[model samples]
Target: MSRRALRGVLGIALLLILWEGVARGFALPSYTLPSVSEILLSVWRQRQLLASAAWFTMAEALAGYAIGCVAGIGIAVLLSLLPPVRRGMMPAMMAINSVPVAAWSPLLLLWLGVGIASKIAAVALAVGFTVFLSALAGLDRVDRRTIGLMRSFGAGPLSILWRLRLPTALPLIASGMRVSTVRSLIVAIVTEMLGAYGGLGWIIYQAVVQIDFVSVWSAILVASALSLAFFGLIGAIERRVVFWR
Candidate 1:
C-alpha cells in the first residue's frame, strides 16, 4: 500500500485498539459500550438482515442523489442563461436552503408519508442546495474577458455556456457531487430514523429501544462503510471526468 494508505490503516488500528481496551478495561456492559469484537461478531451474525436494510437505504439515497444532481445542474444552467430570473429567484432559493434538512424532514414526512418518498425528498433537498451553489459559483467563475471575446466572435450565450462555462465549471461541480454523496446518505438515514418501514436507521432505532448497543454499533459500521463506498465512487468518477485537474 502507499504511504498515505498505510498511515490511514495504522490510525484506524490504533483507534480500534483503544476502543477495545477501554470497553474491556471498564467492563462495560453490552448495552452501554460493547467491545469492537462483540460488534464485529454481531455484524457477522446479523449480516443478512443488515444487508437487506442497507440495500433499502442505499436505494433511497441513490434515487435522491440522481434527482438532486440533475435538478441542481439544470437549474444552475437555466439561471446562468437568464440573469433577470436569477436575480429574482436567488434570494428565494437561499431562504429555502437556509432551513436545515432536518427541519424540512418532518414536513416532508407529513406530506409524502413515512414511506421511501419522504426519505428521498429529504436527501434530495439536502443535496440539491449543496450542488446548486457549487454549480452556480463555478458557472459564474468564467472570466469577463473570455465572455466578451466569445461574444465578439459571434458565440451566443448557449454556445459560450456549452464550450466555455460548462467546462470551466466542471471541477467545482464535481467537488459538489463528491461532497453530496455523503450528505445524501446521511439525510436518507436521518429521515429514515424519524419514520421508515425499513432502513439502517430504522434498525438502529429498534436496536436502541431494545438496549442492543452492539446492534446499534453494527448498523453504524454498515452505514459508515456505505458512506465511504458512495464517496469513493463519486471521487473515482470525478477523477475520470475532471482528468485535467
Candidate 2:
C-alpha cells in the first residue's frame, strides 16, 4: 500500500486496539459497548442478514443519488443559463435547503408512505441542495471577460455553457458529487430507521428494540462499509470524469 493508505490503516488499527483494551479492561457490558472481537464475531455470525439489509440500503442510496445528481446539475444549468430564473428561484431554494433532512423525514413519510420512496426522497432532498449549490457556484466562477469573448465569437448561452462554463465548473461539480455520496447513504438510512420495509437502518431499529446492541453495532459497521464504498466509487468516477484536475 502507499504511504497514505498505510497510515490510514495503521490509525484505524490503533483505534481498534484501544477500543478493545478499554472494553476488556472495564469489563463493559455488550449493551454498553462490546469489544471489537465481539462485534466482529457478531458481524460474521449475522453476515447473511446484514448483507441483505446492506443491499437494500445501498439500492435506495444509489437510486436517490442518481436522481439527486441529475436534478441538481440540471437545475444549476437551467439557472445559470437563465439569469432571471436564478434571481427568482435562489431565495426559495435557499429557504428549502436550510431545513435539515431529519426535519423533512416525518412529512415525507406521511406524504410518500413508509416505503422506499420516502427514503429515496429524503436522500435526494439532502443531496440535491448540496450539489446544486456547488454546481451553481462553479458555473458562476467564469470571468465576465471570458463570457464576453465567447459571445463575440458568436457563442450563444448554450454554446458558452457547453464550451466554456461547463468545463470551468467541472471541478466544483465533481467535488459536490463526491461529498454527496456519504450524505445520500446517511439520509437514506436515517429515513429507513424512521420507517422502512428492510434496510440497515431497519435492522438497527429492530436490534435496538430487542436489546441486541451487538447486532446494532454490526448493522452500523455494515452501513459504514457501504458508505465508504459509495464514497470511493464516486471519488473514482470523479477522478476519471474530471481528468484535468
Candidate 3:
C-alpha cells in the first residue's frame, strides 16, 4: 500500500484503539456503550444483513446520483446557452434548494410512495442544486476572450462549446459529482429511516429502537466506510478526468 493509504489505516487504527480504551476504562455498560471489539463482533455476526442493507443503500444512492447529475448537467447547459433564462431562474433555484430535505422527506414519501421512489426523490432533490450551481459556475468560467477569438476565427457556437466550455467545465462538474455522490448516500439513508424499506439507515434506526447499541455503532461504521469509499472513488475519477490541471 501507498504511504498515504498506510497513514490513513494507522490513523483509523489509533482512533479505534482510543475508543476501545475509553469504553473499557470507563466501564460503560455494553448496552449503553459497547467496546470496539463488541461492535466488531456484532458486525461480524450480522454481516449478511449488513451486506444486504448496504447493497440496497448503495443502489439507491447511485441511482439518485446518476439522475441528479444528468438533470443538473442538462439544465445547466441550457442555462449557459441562455443567459437571460439563467438570470431569471437563479434566485428561484436558490430558494428551492434552501428548503430543507429533512422537511421534505415526509411529503416526498407521501407523494412518491414509501419505496425506492421516495428515497430517490429525496436524494436527488438533496443533491441536484449543488450539482447544478457548481456546473453552471464551471461553465461560466469559459473565457470570453477565447469565445471572441473563436468568433474571429469563424468558429461556430457548437464548436466553441464543444472544444472550450465542455473541457473547462469538467473539473467543476467532477467536484459537484463528488459532493452529489456523498449527499446522495446521506439523503437516501435518512429518507429510508424516515420512510422506506431496507437500508443501512433503516438498520441503524431498527438497532436503536431495539436498544442494540453495538449493532447501531456497527451500522454507523459501515455507513462511514461506504461514504469514504465512494468519496475516494470520486477523487480517483477526478484525478483522471482533470489530469492536465
Best model number under lDDT: 1
Query: The CA-based lDDT of model 2 is what?
Result: 0.92
Model 2, range 1-245, lDDT digits (tens) per residue? 77977897899899999999999999999999899999999999999999999999999998899899899999999999889999999999999998899999999999999999999899888888999999999999999999999899898999999999999999999999999999998898899889999999999999999999999999988888888788878888998999989
Task: Summarize candidate 3's per-residue lDDT along 1-245 as a digit string, tens digits.
Answer: 98998999999999999989999999999887789998889899999999999999999998888888888888999899888998999899888888888899999999999899889888877777778888898999988998999999999877987899989998998899987777888898889898778999899889879988788889888888899999999988898889987
Per-residue accuracy of model 1 over 8-97 as CA lDDT, tens digit each: 789989999999999999999987889999999999999999999999999999999999999999999999999999999999999999
Candidate 2, position 184, lDDT: 90
Candidate with better lDDT, 2 vs 3:
2
lDDT of 1 at 76: 96
Off by over 4 Å in 3: none
Report the lDDT of model 2 for residue 6.
89
Segments in model 2 whose C-alpha atoms lie over 4 Å from true places: none
- Of candidate 3, the 10-residue stretch with the lowest lDDT total is 121-130
Pick by TM-score: which candidate is best? 2
Against the reference, the lDDT scores of all candidates come to: 0.95, 0.92, 0.88
lDDT of 3: 0.88
Where is model 2 poorest over a 10-residue stretch in terms of lDDT?
224-233
lDDT of 2 at 102: 94
